[model samples]
Target: MSKLDIKQLTKQIIDGVGGEENIVSAAHCSTRLRIVLKDDSLIETDIVAEIDGVKGSFNNGGQFQIILGTGLVNQVYQEFLVQTDLSEVGKEELKEIASSKLNIAQRILKALADVFVPILPALVASGLLMGLNNLLTAEGLFVSGETVIGAYPQFADLAEMINIFANTAFVFLPILIGFYAAKIFGGTPVLGAVIGAIMIHPDLLNGYSYGQAVLDNTVPVWNVFGFEIAKVGYQGTVLPVIGAAFVLAKTEKVLRKFIPMMLDNIITPLLAVLFTASFTFIAIGPVMRVVGDWMTNGVMWLFFELGPIGGAIYGVVYPLLVITGMHHSLVTSEMQILANIETLGGSPTFAVVAASNVAQGAAALAVFYLFKKDVKMKAIASAAGISALLGITEPAVFGVNLKLKYPFVAALIGSAAGAAYATWREVLSVSQGPAGLPGVIVIRPQSMVQYMVALGIAFVVTFVVTILFAKMSQGKSKLN
Candidate 1:
């Protein structure tokens, strides 16, 4: 068999899928090409799946997806953008760049975006309701004696449920991430989730003390093979579990291949579980917890040194982080900040970040209005924009902003402006929450008002800019 050049194979795969002409818009989930087609009738699903580098093809939830393994999916998507004429109007000059000084940073930012996309909606809805709960509770609406309308009574229980669901994701998110990591590593998700569950177990939590001394003047008290171990918590974490699961999966695979067939099924699983669990508890978790703590300390250093400016910078950078999936790296830091501060009361940049999402959504809406003739693009734009307004930016950013050239620029502009205002005002949040407009209410009410004003200005700026740019660049070429 001839060895296939992956680059050439990827190009061929895209060409086979209606040659970009049949593609309406293209985005990605974790491991699949979530493509919208100009005409589904033109797609030859079987033939596409048969292509050299293609994994599989399927249609679900009104999306025609082509599955490709992790790293290759984005490469294939880029190939489509470069080889085809799907470039949005006015942004043709920015297409097909092979290298740049900021390439590393850009890649990192894109990773952050991807990691947060799947969890955005749930985070937003919960954060929004959480903020509302605070507002209603403070205003004597929920527990007040004087009330003509029973809106408070009807919503109180529902609000509590939403709050629990939203916070639960952050509290136990490691388990969910571990499941996905396991799948990525070709291991059983259940096994990985069990590892995460162990890390967060009550016994483990009760055993670790934050300020306990592990060493006295360089002489270690706690030691594993003469190495001092740092005591730390692993709840709501990411890297440690993922790294451990990968090792476990590889070990499982190796054991299955080498062990005698008679003992493989029972003995392999038992060994895999025992070894992996022991390694995690005795080694990986402690090491990773130290690393996570160091990272939190670094972020805190910046926060204290730069104050609101640091937050504004974080806000401006966060969306790009979301794009690349590196945002997972920040989760430990954010959670630590919450644990330390107990409230977002000292920093206002959270509100700015939330506002930027609204701006991105507004930009999408602008694209929809400007591209009236392209009904499919219009619908996608509308859906994405509306979703963003409601605090879900995955559909807007991945489905629309990045695809439509002007929208991303609009979002950037809005984010920068909003961040600047947030920094200037010194607005502070009362709690940590999702990145969206409704989540802005987590800030002190007075600060939230200022944040809302900043967001309003950002929305207008982004909307106007996107509309003007879209109209100015109209008729250059359609997305299809």
Candidate 2:
């Protein structure tokens, strides 16, 4: 309701948090000022929360978060930066600092997230279009055509064009992975792109359908430096490409050290690409792929052996994993399912993920309704709930449910129940997309209704349970 001095507000927040000495790192996302504190006990929570323009404050995921609205948060964060020496602290650095506090497993999971998260937008967009194409060309939707004209008598060209859009991302997925992975590893992105291009060159056999060639004993192999190398392209691969990128980055760094400044442009990139590509194909690609398959099968074995109970546990753990930034590690499993539906069956992981996502939104919605008197919190909850339903749960998880504590537990219970029901029904998703309400777009057509039922279960159960929790807590459990 009132404009206040940002400098004053920044000073208050820093001083309240025991000054810059107490803060390990600081970063901001959309609607919160996220800070990692060296000592939580030293934080003057009440003082910081009482600051004007501050909406709410809480700690989760190893970060002390202040819920300032988007525009205000950025401004305060900038002023806070100016007042302190944390100006150079970027999001990645802060993430690393936060992740350092986690155990080895969590650190590995976070590393997995770091690799996959940046690439998710490409995956989501392409997956959505592909799903729509499948739906449009389904048996009852479009008649099968024997010839080009017969296939699309009216919209043949349009259909062909749309198919290209749907297929491009997946077709060039390795290139995308290379570009992003190289950037993440601090290498020249163009070198990674070149390496990716080499992997999928026209001379190479298609990796996706190479099994038939293997069965027929016709798969191509190349003799290089007395080593036999597979000539299969990496189309939908995950680990091999990422591993290759890391290798390329390290190799380039080593090259940079010895190569003179003037000769760098020609020698550095050439040597880097040449060595890295050879090393990747000769060793890294084959080895990481086997490791990736092992990880995928391990997860699938647990899912099938445990059946519905496994799905329930997966659903419960996923949201908590999200808070710790570990759930994205499961992408390797989902990628396997997406690429090998015939062998692996469709993805049960999606059914559980959808359940978890909807439950998060439901929990946030309940908090919104229960905290009707706390206008700022109610506003935050409403925004977060909407975000979660759209398949982005960070706002809902960090800004609302986890902040409130009890609601997060209630959501976990609801998620487990809903996931068990979905697993029993054998609901499956064919591709990646936003989970929760939007998940219906990517689920198998035959199982779409069942998936919807699972979502409804998650939402209703979480909402009801959270309401009860809020009522019992009597407003005392809220974060200020």
Indicate which candidate wins on TM-score.
2
Candidate 2, residues 343-362, lDDT tens digits: the string is: 55467898898899889999
**What are the lDDT scores of the predictions, listed in order?**
0.62, 0.79
> Stretches of candidate 2 above 4 Å error?
1-9, 24-27, 36-64, 82-111, 141-157, 210-219, 302-307, 339-347, 371-380, 444-447, 470-480
Best by lDDT: 2
User: For candidate 2, which ten residues in a row score worst on lDDT?
Assistant: 140-149
TM-score of every model?
0.56, 0.82
lDDT of 1 by residue, 1-480 (tens): 122465577566666667666665566655566666656677766577456545445543335666565777667666666666565322112211211222565443433333344545554454555555556545444446533124447766766776575466656656765665665566777777777676666645322244343332332234668765433446645557766777777878988888999998788878887888778877787677677668766765555667656655766687787675455556545544433332333334466667778888888888888877976667667866876876767667765777656788878777767766766676666455655676665665546678788778778888988877776676565633
* Residue 389, model 2: Cα distance from true site in angstroms: 2.6
Model 1: CA > 4 A from native: 1-180, 201-208, 212-233, 298-304, 319-353, 364-384, 391-407, 420-451, 464-480
